[model samples]
Target: MNDKRASHGFRLTLAMLACVGAATLAGCNGGGDAHAQGRKGGEATAWGLPYFNMPDIVPPNVRQDAYTPLTDAQAGPPIDPIKGYRTEDLGGGVYMVGDGIYNTMFVVSDAGVILVDAPPSMGEKTLNAIQQVAPGSKIVALIYSHAHIDHIGFAAGVVKAFPGIPIYAHEETRKALAQANDPNRPVPTNTFNTLDVDFPVVVGNQKLVLRYPGPNHDPGNIGIYHPGQKVLMLVDVVYPGWMMWRRLGLATNIPGYFGLVKSMNARWDFDKLIAGHFQPGTKADVETQLEFMTDMHNALTEAISTIPYSDGRLNAADTKNSWAATRDWTDRLTNHCVNKVTPKWSTRLASFDVWIYEQCMALEQSIRIDGPSLR
Candidate 1:
């Protein structure tokens, strides 16, 4: 019995060391702690030993079948270096203007031009994009999809240039902007609370609908639908060809986010989807993400059920007194979920292996603590 206990202790120590090394090597500089549960609050360690010196986390071996191929859209024409942005018409006067990484929309109307979400990355390039598509047409309005500075911060610049153009956002967004007090992201001149679900802004033949599809990304994130163009614009919710941004795009409400994805897919009649991140997508792409998320949900459910809350090999006193047990359980559960889903999703979604652990951790927390509740 003594020899058996010693052997178990040694193996447990090695496993802990491996995890510490992986976390250290992986660089814990990610957005937030696992589940935003306020960090482990000590020297972040693996098995009570300092983990900073450990080697990086080893990714699971990529199966030949799990490789994600770049679609034609992703490999589409490079942004013109000279122009600094590319403007592609999506028919009916709606245009997708990308300054390489981020894309926004602009609709040409008889009265003037309407711009949606002027990302700071686009900078002066946004003005140049508008010039290429609708020359001499003044921007009469600016639509903010959400209060995220990355997406709507440049609206301040646009407002300065086009003065008096109405800035539109959901009531939740207006409140968020006021609290954030960011100079770059000015509060909206027009705000809509729960009373207004569908707010339409008509610019000649161009009709843009601003909607609060319940809080998914942030409190006031709104969706922009251009019915005339058969295009629906929402940001940070779905990635067309890639795995979702880390932590399900850092969603505040996980179930709400999932619900939004399902509701949006069924509710809209548009052919083209402007997810406001990666490549704009088709109905098929939206369905692809939905399928991937469903698979993740199922995988997490299984991991939660089969994985023991505490590994028997762990030191009982250490497990009870320290972060060891929680850490051990999370490591085991995360790997289990990763093994189950990565085989199929890695091949279908870009960067699946890169961010899958964080994705699983976030979902596991939501399932356990959030109690399957939707607010």
Candidate 2:
């Protein structure tokens, strides 16, 4: 394995030099000029390598929003200080509340209401959204999408607003929260320990299907389904329009993350997906993500197999500097994947250029070290 990996790294280094010769030049003053030229045409030439043969596939309905310079809609309605969060009705008593990023779901029923994942960013705004839409409705249940502090960090707020409300989460989430002691995210009131279980939250006329689709984003993150509304709320797993967060949502299990996407694509019969971030996503959005991930994976695998050495800094006899050499090799491998994958993906996905390399680096580490292990 070591010999093969070294050969793979050598090939990758050669490819990097061929693709971005000026940037890879050991000490060239004209590196900046070379980089600029590379941007103009080097990007195209670099992507022509055999590893990146995946067709430039993207969904017809993919979002083309700019990464910076927030448009009026992206900036969110004139920031009313008094009205905390913006609420978008997803119909059938389901709604999404957030300030562009960090979103959660809520459903109103005759009995009361069900709220999912209250991040500290939303804070009291989540309650405001609930009240704005369902006036006089009591929050009866709080669902923890996972044990992540960023997603459910405002548990104290929820408990304060609706005392004694039953909280639902997978058993692993309960355990993780119990161990962490984060004041923002409290332990759940109820927990389930199964990989896949159908636990229904029935209040009055509303019913939500709480499912554990085997730990993808976190140990116990779940997919909340509103059968009547035909909407699925899977937190931190999929970004609606923009690129998936750094490290593919910082997944604990990379393969598990991919599996979760496939599982939802094959099984869910919903129209809209409340993918836990950005704007509301659709089936097409989900499909686009799958395509992006698969393309990156294929490109990374090919580069790893074809490279001649791990890092360009070390030769066959550099046994004394092995650790330093390994570190440098990782960066070279990461950059090669980045240069190769960005061109095709940048045109199709929003902010693809911004986060593509970060995602590539994360995947490179996982693939090289973890070797396709789900965990």
For every model shown, the clashing-pair count is 2, 14
**Candidate whose TM-score is highest:** 1
Question: Candidate 1 lDDT (Cα, whole model)?
Answer: 0.74
lDDT of each: 0.74, 0.73
Estimate the TM-score for candidate 2.
0.79
Candidate 2 wrong stretches, greater than 4 Å? 1-84, 310-319, 373-375
Query: TM-score, each model?
Result: 0.81, 0.79
Worst 10 residues of 2 by lDDT: 51-60
Q: Over the stretch 22-92, how does candidate 1's per-residue lDDT look in tens digits?
A: 45333331223321211243332223432222223333331222334566665556878898788878999
Candidate 1 lDDT for residue 245: 86
Off by over 4 Å in 1: 1-76, 315-317, 373-375
The 10 consecutive residues of candidate 1 with the worst lDDT sum are 29-38
